[model samples]
Target: MSWLTIARWDARAVLRDRWFISVAGAFGSLVIAAALVALGSVDVLGVSAFGRVAATLIHLGMLFIPLIGLTVGAVWIAGERESGSLVLLLSQPVERRTVFSAKYLGVAWGMTGAVAVGFGAAGLLLALRAGTDRIPAFLWLVVLSSLLALAMLATGFLISAGSPSRSRALGTALLVWLALVIVSDLGILGTAMILRLPAWAVLVLGSLNPVSAFRLAAIVGITGSADLTGPVGLYAADRLGFAGLLGALVLILAAWTGGAYLLGRKRFLEAVEG
Candidate 1:
């Protein structure tokens, strides 16, 4: 009946899921190990240790953000619904909106924590190895990483809520991820081929993809450089500054989350009664 009650239940459900813990643990360990290896190979003495640390965190965080966000979050609710547990939970005295909000908060918070651990582990290793390169970027890394994670989780939650079946929700989520990562590049390539445009044109279009923006944001935030040179990379270099790209990512992600929620809100209600 109460929002707090639903929040508690949602938290309990997420905590009990072995899948969430297993994936989080594996990812966190792998990222931390990779960062340590990188740090060991680089020369840190008399170098900007703070900058190295920041760059490392951002670099590693970029790879994991979307994976954690979409892959893990997408299935949270849809899986429950497919298993018939979501309906059983809602059939309790809890309000539907409250149930949705609580579940969102639980999963979002849980995911954010997982990402923080992964990034934090990487940061610690960098510190131990590099002593610190650009410390300021650490602040940016934390804030941006959290937002990135939230964006992923929220999008997944929305899709899960709206889909008629778990398979559909997961398929759509994976498709969206693929489109963000690889499809955008393919689209640019296809367009450039058909249009016979200048090389710069292809470069520009690829940079505009949200995934490119996120990658550039991570690079710029950590290294204080944007070296986009080949295909989509070059376009990113020309189009976005460090701040501009991050701002764009925030805006685009917000739109995705908001739109998903709007659709989910309607779909959940319809499905509940049906």
Candidate 2:
């Protein structure tokens, strides 16, 4: 079968998966709740209520999207291997790379759809409550959030390809998620306290992780929350300018997705050949 067929099959499988449904539901609920809560507060004459909601949603996206993306991606290939479906698929005329690419696209699109539904619901609510001017900011939030999800999904695929079992792949994916989401921040805080890290150093270190890069980009680029991002944000804004920093963030996320896909494809091929 062709890669498109494989992608379609996998997409259908994702739709049937209970875990995906639960995660997507949770994401949507959270976004809707955030919008309602933000609206409860009074909007100042100049301040945009949609902007506040979008900022809150960005933080929420940072937490939720990566976890969901990783879970979906980790199971894509490893689950097939566990069920002996990978072998059957390989027996077909499809190239290994095609299979891998198809799986990635399927998972990526599935996760992106989930995110869009959640965030779109929130955006619609915001548009109703706030002015239409906020639509552009909401759109930017959607694009950046999708980019972050794809990056995390790529990392999950890498873990799945390298793991021998579905369980191991899942365990590794969780660990990777924890490292990027929690441990990395703690380490940076501790190191900064101990070493009195320079602003440039903090920016450099933060940009290394996709999650952190997403946060930096959202806060600095979309929300204009330079104060919240601290000196690192200022450094980025000063050196790279807002447009340049955004360009760099996009490049970093793209690199994460592309590099992980290439590496994962190689490992998947090796596993099938062996």
Candidate 3:
């Protein structure tokens, strides 16, 4: 079958999965909760009303997006292999690379749909409650969040490819999620504290990680000033400029997502169809 055909099938399957609704609902609830919470708060360091909620949601997005993206991706190939579905699909005339590409494309679209609902709902609510002016910034945050989700999903593919079974793949995915969270935070802190790297150097190193890059970019959206993100932000704002920082963050995110997916696909081919 053609790649498009396979991708359509996989997208449909992923979107229709039982957990999909729950995922969407979780995002909606988070937005509503954050909106209500923002109303009670006095100030988020002088950020606009929408900015306050957006800032809170950015952190929540960082946590939720990666978890959902990685977990769903981790289960994808591993579950298929464990269930013997991969073998059945392989029996078709399609090439293994085609299968991998199609599967990822399909799943990416499925996930995009779910995340759009979540982020979109937040934007809509903010527009109604806050105003339409900052909608552009929130929309930009949505784009960055989508990229971050894709990056995590790509990492999950590597986990699923290397793993021999679904449970192991899922477990590995969780450990990986925790490692990235811990390492990205402590790792940055350690670099600054132990290495005594210059602020510019530390900011550059921090953006190397997709999650960090996303957070840094989101900071601009929330605060309209990267300097508010702390010293790293201050350094980047002075040395790199906002345009430079955005360009660098986008490039880093693209590299992580593309590099991880290609590497994972190669491993899957060797392991499953070698």
Candidate 4:
């Protein structure tokens, strides 16, 4: 089987799904709405209005994109297995790896498309209203958000490969999201506070979370200074600077995406052969 053909078919299938459509629509609406809301934020002398919008975009994009990628991906394999479709598909002439990789490609394309539309619309709105000075930062928001989505997709795909049913995959996906996005950040911060960790140490702790990696990149892009992120930001600004931090955070995300996909692929292959 041509993996490209399967990938394209899967992308079309994802686009046609009502749940994905609704979620993408909501994400797009939120992006535009966030830009509009950020316009009301007070702009300091040196900062462009679009910079403020980028901040809001970062928060909203990070929050929702992970949900979109993970929840859908979590069911990609498990749902088919539960319905007995996966067995039928595996019996075809196509190799298991083709199906595994192709499905991921198709789904990734769908999620990436959604992220682009949402962030692109927000960027355009900001450019029109606040001028284009911060367009680069807005672009960074899109790129970082897309990376985070892909990383989350990899994680959810791993979960799907091992899960027995859609319900369990979904429940597990939610817990993963909660742990990475919410609990990890809060727990790290509280630990830093109680331990009186230095700014550099807090920065290290934050980078371990994928969401925080995206946030670090976003803060550097939008504000041109990590100080906007408070104490950790302050240290990042002095020690690592923009290029350093952005590169580091992006690498972290890339590692997660690659590592999870490799593990998921191994499990999926075993599942097919079993």
TM-score of each: 0.80, 0.94, 0.92, 0.92
Count of backbone collisions in candidate 1: 10
State how far residue 66 of model 4 sits from its true place (Å): 0.8
Residues 64-177 of candidate 4: C-alpha lDDT, one tens digit per residue: 888888888999899999999888878878888899999999999988988898788887777776777777867877888899999999998999998899999999999999
Model 3 over residues 1-274: C-alpha lDDT tens digits? 5999998998899877765557656865887789667744524433367767877888887778888778888889999999999999999999989988898888888888778877787777777766687788888888998898889889988888877899999899888888676577787888689978887778877878788888888887556778668888778877878888788888888899999899999999998767
RMSD of 2: 1.7
> Of models 2 and 3, which has the larger TM-score?
2
- List where candidate 3 sits over 4 angstroms from the true fold: 39-47
lDDT of each: 0.67, 0.84, 0.81, 0.84
Predict model 3's lDDT versus the native. 0.81
Query: In candidate 4, which residue ranges exceed 4 Å CA deviation?
Result: 40-47, 194-200
Cα misplacement distance, residue 224 of candidate 4 (Å): 1.1
Better of 2 and 4 by TM-score: 2
Candidate with the greatest TM-score versus the true structure: 2
Ranking by TM-score: 2, 3, 4, 1
